[model samples]
Target: MRRKLTLKDVSRESGLSTFTVSRALAGAEGVSKESREAVLRVAEEMGYVPNLAAQKLRGVASSTIAVITAGTSNAYYLDMMNGIQAVAQDMDQTVVLTDIAIGGVYDIGRERQTIQRLLEGRVGGVISTLTLLPESVKRLEDWEIPIVFVDSSPPEELPYVPSVTTDNYNASLLVGAHLQSHAFQDWLLLVYPPIWSSRKERERGLRDAAAKAGATIEVVEAGNNAASASKALRDCLGRRGGRLPDILIAGNNPILLGAFQVARERNTIIPDNMAMVCFDDFPFAPYLDPPVTVLNERSEEIGRLSAHMLTEIMSAQIEARKAGKPAAPIYTNEHQLQVPVDLVVRRSCGCPDPTRSRS
Candidate 1:
């Protein structure tokens, strides 16, 4: 059997320190051009190949992008993850998915712990699906770990952080208008809490629309999962003495399912008995009994854009560090973008097949 060469052998032949040889072999910064060339030449002559698995076992930092998500059961995340994974695969980067939700609910203690874990792991970058606490955001920034928020934003105090999301306010307005077109006077919005941050803009738009149309809108808060949403809807209906709202606006996919479950338990028909609409478009949205009206927020596109933006920042940071420059990720106005949404009209909103949308 032939002896497998090592960095030590390259170091012995090149007359460079083992540390320099290792850095040169990894193509990392801090090695001079001439030293790197000599190290490469010696390494080629010695037939030394870097072992990635061994490097990982030795606690070396990895270029793994972390995607922090809440409400993992929501179908919206599946398509979003697909988009992020596609970008990561193309970039030859690995992705780690971390859910801060415990028992299908977002927990502050878990958020704090997750942040510390990622920092300790020395991850290459992060893509968060919710607005993290101010302290968590601060800690990540202080560590120079590039982060991109997808479907969310930075803390209000850190307005310059990069984010890619839908224009939720406008999307809400679009939803409200379609509902108003059906002459719905009483509205009910079943939504998750502000931990997601998107709830704020979405509620604001709906509120404004309700006021403009002189319609009464009731907002119901629920956990970010289907079970909680189902209970919230049941409770709200109980308080209303079983009086269903003119139209029900679901916050997301999970909430939508919860609403459907409640409707089923009561033997209620959609549109005729009570109309329905939701924030996100899922695979089964159009295939349901009556189909569903939805605000197509383009989740996959948002995910892809967020990952691309993070990778670009990471690349820039690497180049800067290589040139002995400040390596913090550079963010600009362009880094914070909101993709427009389209209203996909289906029969659930009382629209006929001819009135159905193509979005």
Candidate 2:
């Protein structure tokens, strides 16, 4: 029988100490980048497979589930994290939060590195809000680690992966119907770049609805931060000669806040002059001066479902291994789960709140 490749072999091939080889492959800190890369390359070339049994034995008392996300500053992500923690605490599983620098454009190199670091024997599974490259998805599949996506999904080119996301298209359709009820004609939609699937779907739904209603819709691609959103809104308003749209829709809470800043600075009136709606429902949304209308995406529910799905997949994989059977893929045609959204109406959308008496 062929001898199984070992760390000593990788150490010898990479001209590094055994300790260095082990630490590098395990993605430990303090190792030079050059040495880490060399050790990983040598191990791959020598077909050095990780000893899963030994790794489990070493840390049998503790196992972690990693949640990878971007833009921790957003309250949306924080809400989802809270839901995930609620479930994780009940199960007595440790959840580790990791952030990646994903944005409008996919960064394959950074994503791959992040996944490799998580795979170094500590994390038993992952729940990610960031969409990963196809290659990275395949790597996770080959390693037999379960991954459940929240709020985003892998590219269409890849096979179906277990994911939990909101029905954004339907949510936007509801927004469109609400706007139409007020006989609003011209519209302006401030959205993040089209790289995100959620953004694309929402835009599609709005465009389709607008086409049916004969209302003109103009889309502006604002960046994913408050500063960028403010700049984009200001520029769009300037180009229009200070004339606001009949109704303005902000893609998310951050974008809505930016628009609020600009509207206040320019002294724009609400509902009577221009109606406003936002896609996310945060705690402060109802407390705003006009109490902005918003789409409640049930972020906490998404997190709970995602964590539950990941745990189920991991449990199945464990059972399969114990029976000496190859683990089956978690995703199938039925794996796509969509949580519904609710529209909360307030003064911003020309709807009167009963709590506040009309003047």
Candidate 3:
């Protein structure tokens, strides 16, 4: 049988102390770039795999981080994960993804347990898309790991963790302004419950922009699916003397998809009966019946930036610990590293249809 691959093999092959070899492979980042490459190369040649669980037993960092989100079903979430994955690959960090999609009752339980497992493994850090359990936040001080939150509210105003997100309010303002310039009078904002930060902020922005333009605005709430949104739309139209909204701002991509379904059911003409826009852009947005006017949320960039932030926080925490100082975590606000948004105008907004009008 071949000899077993171990840290001793890496240390001997790389002329570095076992500790240095360990740090290099564990993503500690204190070792010089040249030294890290040397250690990693020899370990790879020797087929030595660092055991993360064993490292945790020795109170050492794992070269892994966890990224928890609702699910991979949502295209927006998938884009965010793609961004995070790109950064993770560059940093040679492994990512653990946990999907919570059963229901609210089960989600809370799963999120907390999954986080606890990651903590016990001594993951280098964590980047979560909210849905983290309150208990996890309360016990974060004990974990002492670098943390980053994406598209969610930070817990208890903890100023140490970083957040990566889009400007929901301003994105909404762009949509409202576009409609106002078009002279669309009656507007309807169809969204899910306003409990979500994205929905609440976008609604506020829409209201502000509409008020300034002297356009009438109405709000309607839809359940999580298209069927509910369709029913809601039909009910609104029946109550309004069969008149349709001049403009419709769907709070998110799924909601917009639902609105489009409702429009089809009602046999309404796009931009002739109603104009439509969505808060977040989708992959196939340009191929729709009337290419959609979308407020691009930069979802992928949010994930990429959050990963970078976590890497920075992990580095800082390691240095502070090495210097025997308090590991003062860095909490970057949306202002410090906020992602920008763009409003892409297409045929759906009652503007001249680009396909036919451009030529």
Give the winner by TM-score: 2 or 3.
Answer: 2
Candidate 3 residue lDDT tens string, 42-112: 98676565666775674445467788775354577778989989998998888888765432113566776
Worst 10 residues of 2 by lDDT: 101-110
- Estimate every model's Cα lDDT from 0 to 1: 0.87, 0.80, 0.75
lDDT of 1: 0.87
Sorted on TM-score, best first, the list reads 2, 1, 3
Candidate 3, superposed: residue stretches over 4 Å from native: 1-61, 101-106, 131-134, 224-228, 238-242, 323-328, 332-336, 355-359
**Candidate 1 local lDDT, 221-285, one digit each (tens):** 99988899999999999999999999999999899999999999999999899999999989999
List model 2 lDDT by residue over 153-263, tens digit each. 766777478889888888889999988888888999999876556888899999987877789999998877677788998999889998899999998887887788888
In every candidate, how many clashes are there? 0, 0, 0
Among all candidates shown, the one with the greatest TM-score: 2
Q: Supply the global lDDT for candidate 2.
A: 0.80
TM-score, cand. 3 vs. native = 0.75
Model 1 Cα shift for residue 4 (angstroms): 36
Candidate 1 lands at a TM-score of: 0.82
My TM-score estimates for the predictions, one after another, are 0.82, 0.86, 0.75
Evaluated at residue 6, the lDDT of candidate 1 is 69
